[model samples]
Target: MSATEVKLFGKWTYEDVMLSDLSLVDYIAVNKAAQSFLPHTQGRYQMRRFRKALCPIVERLCCSIMMHGRNNGKKLMAVRIVKHAFEIIHLLTDKNPIQVFVDAVKNGGPREDSTRVGSAGVVRRQAVDVSPLRRVNQAIYLICTGARNSAFRNIKSISECLADEIMNAAKESSNSDLAAQLAVSAATFQRMIAQDAWKFLKYMWVNSVASDIPPLTHPWAWGLPVTASLTFSQGYAIKKKACFAAKVSFLHRINEHVLEEFYKDYRVDDAAMHVGESAARVILLH
Candidate 1:
């Protein structure tokens, strides 16, 4: 089998040492002294990528090395003779724990990422959050890198499910006004994710470098008079503007996964777009 025999012979191990008693200034110095050993892309272990992909540890170890040591004020005292020199020679190195594990469980321990299976039959468990886009306080991280990438592909599937959700919510409520608003929102979302998306991509390609296009922010106030929004022309303009912004961001990091058919998909629906516009205004007026 694999080498499972433990050969322990070292007098001392270079490991993460947390000194709770260390003064703030000394702590800062110690942290700086050993910071070079912290792994970056260049100094990574050959097994690191493999470890990130295959190692089945859920919780990362929080390790910090002693920084400030020896007698020029602060809590500077260590191994009698070589205290100062000892700190400089050994750099503190450990797995950097992400906030995902920090908030994962009340008492955090090792865990696995079930969803992150790499192509080489390894599971990437380190520095990855299981919940990519969980809504926090109902505020969406509009610029989440992983979430935004996945959303581009999966939004169509999600919008289809939302139609059923709208119907269920409508059935539960006696409020026709609420039902109407939900219907408008659902229709808007459906048009957003499905039909208009392909057309918008073409618009983006045409206006890729157009400085006149405004950045995509919350155009319609989801707060006061929630239904108040733009007409078909206005809605289309804003959507097209947002599409331009998104494409620009995607361009910086484009890969084979990004859709390459922008110039080809020119056919667009005019009638449905008009219908959506009409419906939106109707909801706002009532």
Candidate 2:
């Protein structure tokens, strides 16, 4: 298992909020406000996590309001107030609904003044076109989180497959003078392997991170490219370094399930063998 690389697009800032002071009712109200901004169709997919995770933060904020309303005469304990405050901030700052739900579980459910929303329809919904960029981002997130769908993994694998397909086509083509056929030089092809390999691997790495996986550190955790260039002295070193960088980036985005899978997929024995044979040879010989 290698360190997951953190990419600029996936980074987020963390905020601190207290969770203790909020009562259940306050959370419901805040959720209502946030829900109003989301489109109907999108809301359908988002509400569950929001309700589960963010409601407590609202409750805490409401408690603070109530305390202030009482003219500061009644003192709320710092532990409760601070706890709920953090919860509120956490809910507000969280961009991903799934992450929000996970946070809620860690914080425990809503506090007193509970007002449950029935039928899920209480939240307004809206329609919005999903963009290609958004889809790509989501795919990256899913992979970092270590999602288990084989089909999804296969889809991510397409980039690597395409690169190989193109290279093979170039090699087999008989007409060297064919002007329409783009010529990919050996250096260009190696560069493509170096760049695209990391891209595809990073997506997989990020998915593992998002799922809370510990990350794969073993050198052989992922299958090695069979290309001759990849097995060469400099080529192997580059690949290993790329993998190592990716692993570090991934840890910042860790999710529980992803961590579990990392341990399962990457074994110490395999890693040792691959690193000794591939990485050591590359570094030593080059």
Candidate 3:
């Protein structure tokens, strides 16, 4: 019979039937023809072509089964046709056949060991101490720069060397400032340096005012403030003040909109008014 005239019967749906009755060769030929037309088209055209190709093979197999009954010969044929039908469906669907095959293999393979164990108590992470190193380093840098004075060159050089040693200790101790301090005993600054424990040396040098150098107390002098608070309008006013402080006289001549945008970008937080404290304080309070 022609491909379009064949009809699949209901018995073809059985799970464990024989393959011989299904007429495997004819099934393959029809399925091959169906697959060829699937490339250049999609949607309804694809669905129609698949159904047309598959229905005929299914119909012939069904007719064979109905004629032969439930004997071993017919059962074998039915099984083969059902298997072929499954393959055809797989090829036409969106499912990835390779992934499906791999998943099937994995699912059917051996399983890993599954055993229960008693729960352990919760463990807390240890906190690191950083204050000692910060204090020591701050002291060292202060002494080295002689608080940024040009007179005490020798003392500055000695302080810089000590600072370098402290930095190395910090690295070796994995940022453990406490361990660094313990490495260098607290008593007798000269003895501490003799033992290569320059931790307290920087502190001692900083406290000594004999060098006629002022102490650098404000940490904010090193960088911009972290936070500052001012209302939108107040922030703009502070920016204008800072501009004047910097001797930018042209700021008075600039447009208000441009000034507002500039302030929005550079204005510090209320809390971090380190460099702009005076202007920020006046504007925010007012």
Pick the lDDT winner: 2
Each model's lDDT: 0.29, 0.32, 0.30
Q: Pick the candidate with the highest TM-score.
A: 1
Per-residue lDDT value at 213 in model 2: 44
Better of 2 and 3 by lDDT: 2
TM-score, every prediction = 0.17, 0.15, 0.13
Over 1-286, each residue of candidate 3 has an lDDT whose tens digit, in order, gives 4444322232122222222313232322233243321111222423553342333322322223332234334544443433443344345543332222212212221121112233567532221222322332332333223212422355543223323323333233323123223222111111212333222223433444423322233223223232366576765555543422222222233456644543455442221222222322232333
lDDT of 3: 0.30
Ordered from best to worst lDDT, the candidate numbers read 2, 3, 1
lDDT of 2: 0.32
Per-residue lDDT of 1-286 in model 2, one digit per residue for the tens?
A: 1234321113311122222323323333223343322111122323564443333322222223232344342323422332333344335554432233223322221111112333666842221233332322222222212212322457644223322222222233332122111111212222323333335436666444244443445444344443554557756665665455444445335565654554455422222222232332232233
Question: On a 0 to 1 TM-score scale, where does candidate 1 land against the true structure?
Answer: 0.17
